[model samples]
Target: MGSIEDRLRAVEDQLAIADLRGRYCHLLDGRQWPAFIDLFTEDGVFEGLSAVRGRAALTEFFAHRVPAMTEEFWHFCSNGTVVLEGDRASGRISMEYLSVMNGVSYVSAGHYDDEMVKRDGVWRFAARRLTFYFLAPLHEGWAGRPFHNPAA
Candidate 1:
């Protein structure tokens, strides 16, 4: 972070990390297993929908599931904030997931709490936890939010 080369490397790291995230969404949506498996660390964990560990397990998991998901689904991520920590970093990426379930369109807005590591000059996800703010039906919206607790 001091020398010019260091600064450039830092910027490069930032962009690479962002690119990694973009690839994550694209790979998932496109069902590109070979490329997608490379985006995670050997022991990466996904704590969204369910907890999955290791690149092998993740590959196996999505292989069976993704094909069965609705073709109309899309995953859009934005508002990413990444903090550099030498070989490790943490980030939050806001995202919206839209899919048709039972012929009804539903949208879920959330953020991913990410723990990333630079392994062998490549950035990969070590852990990602999806925290949803809301899930709403396209017809009703989130107006009568039932998952909230006004009394508490």
Candidate 2:
């Protein structure tokens, strides 16, 4: 068994990991892709509603998807838990997203299963997988628009 101080250090390390996850969501919401990418390791794999591998893939995915719609979108992440094993860690985060497109709105609620690693005193995401719980569409006009793949 570890000493009390060791346990406390583990708890603190988990908190720091959670804080980094929150910052990632904040940067994404703010459209700061470069800054957001910095949170992940170079070979990171981001898989979720969309699967993006590596920093370059993530950057391309964000560039192609985020700008196609209206700019009114907000993403909130909460209810996260982090588990650490030496230099590697994993976490799950609940996410809520709301967006307005061409005056119409939509919302999605989901959770992200994430894998992280500590390298040279910095924490970075090694992988992330998103699972959606529910999605609700708002406004009637959204149905009229032709379906366009955001990733395209």
Candidate 3:
């Protein structure tokens, strides 16, 4: 068993990881591209359908993509479950992406799966994966497009 000091450090690491994920959602929705790029490790990867490698590439990737929806949407991430091992960790979060189009609200259920690491004493994403379940109008919700990934 680890000592009390080790256990305390683990708890602190977990909190930092949670904060890191929250910042990701905030920066992405706010379209703070520069700050968003800093959220990842220098060699970090963002893996959706394709992969964007490194902070510079990630910046360029989102710069072209995020602004289009900046005024229309934001992400709410919930129920983050994290597993930590020393300076490395992994997490899964349930994301409710809300958007308003033509006065109609639409929501999508998805998962943000992450692999993170602590570098220079700060936690940053090493790799992040996004899997979206469905996009549905508010009235319809996820009833017809339920999320069913056992691995998550």
Candidate 4:
């Protein structure tokens, strides 16, 4: 068994990671682009409907991609499961999203597969990949609809 300090450090790391996940939703929904990009490492990669590598490409990707999709949206992430290995970790988090697209309300369900690294005692995503089960208008629902990766 690990010592007391090790156990405590693990708890602290878990909490910090949880906070990171929450901050992602808030920053994305708030349209705080700069802060949002900061959540990832300098060479971080994001993959979903499309892919972007490094902070510079991420900046360009969001600046162009997000506004084109919708100006208003809410991103929610939950059910996070992480495996810590010293300063590195891997996790999967479930997400539900709502957005106003062309005046229509749409909902999306998905999960994020993340690889994270802790540098200088701070945790950041090294890579994040999203997979969507479905995305559809509120009136239509998800049944019989094709899955989507809506955003990168």
Candidate 5:
């Protein structure tokens, strides 16, 4: 919030961060584990039902868990808001997904609370925390049930 140059930089940064989220969805849904993990910092942490820290752990977690649970999947992200502060930024993104497990259809909705850092001109997630509102099989619906892991 300063000169024209500063304002331009802010817009650019926001767009880049948005791109990161887009790529995250594509990579993960596509099961491109290595590239997906690269979206994070080396010490990045992903907190969902459990916490997976560091790129190595993230790779392991996604590679094993996602495949084990989902036969097919698609991730949709929206309602993202980012606040830039020098080299660090924080944001929230709404997420929804359709998935298939053993020929059973499922749906999930959640939001990600993200802490991101700009490192060497690229923004990467330092931490991503997911809180799900619903994770239910398509037929059963989300009402009157507790949130549970899709994998279980």
Candidate 6:
């Protein structure tokens, strides 16, 4: 059996992992590309509906996709479970993303599979695979209008 101190340390590590996941969502919704990139390990892979590898590639990927959306966006995460093993850990988090475009709102629900590692005393995501369960289609003619500029 693990000692009390060991158990407490494990819980703390899991809580930190959860906090990192939440920060990731916040960075994405806010379009804070640099901050988002900082969350990943140098060799991290981000596989969305489209696969992107490395931080630079992920930046380009976001540049192309995020601006195209004509909406204010929010991503909410729930039911996160983390398993830690020394320097390595894995997690699963359920999520829902909501966006409002031209007075219409759309939502997408999904799950994220994550792998992480502790590097130099800081935890960073080594890989993340986002699997979306459902995505509501945008109403027609929504793209023709100006960008929603959520940051505005």
TM-score of each: 0.88, 0.83, 0.85, 0.94, 0.95, 0.82
Q: For residues 1-152, what per-residue lDDT tens digits would candidate 1 score against the true structure? A: 29998898889999999999999999888888889888889899988666899987888777765555454568899999999989899999999988776677877788999999998999999998988777677787876564321112
Collision pairs in model 1: none
> Model 2: per-residue lDDT, tens digit, 38-150?
88899988876478888999898776566565457787998898878988998788998777766667766778898999888888899988786654555433433433334
Worst 10 residues of 3 by lDDT: 143-152
Error of 5 at 28 (Å): 0.5
- Which portions of model 6 show Cα errors greater than 4 Å? 100-104, 138-152
- lDDT: worst 10-residue window of model 2: 143-152
Q: Which stretches of candidate 1 lie over 4 Å from their true place?
A: 66-71, 144-152
Question: Residue 116 deviation, candidate 5, in Å?
Answer: 0.5
TM-score of 6: 0.82
Between prediction 2 and prediction 4, the one with superior lDDT is 4
Write the residue-wise lDDT of candidate 5 on 38-131 in tens digits.
9999999999867999988898889987688678999899999999998899999999988898898988898999999999999999999999
Q: Give the candidates in order of TM-score, highest first.
A: 5, 4, 1, 3, 2, 6
Candidate maximizing TM-score: 5
lDDT of 5 at 86: 89
RMSD of 2: 4.0
Against the true structure, candidate 5 has what lDDT? Answer: 0.91
Score residue 130 of candidate 1 by CA lDDT: 84
Q: Candidate 4 regions off by >4 Å?
A: 148-152
- Which model scores highest in lDDT? 5
| Residue range 1-152, candidate 3, lDDT tens digits | 69999999999999999899999989888878889899999999998745899988898778875444334778999999999988999989998887775566777878989999998899999999999897767786677775432112
Spell out the clash pairs found in candidate 4. none
lDDT of 6 by residue, 1-152 (tens): 69999998788788889889989988988889999888999888988656788888888777666656545778899999888998889989998877776667766678899999988877889999988775564554333343233323
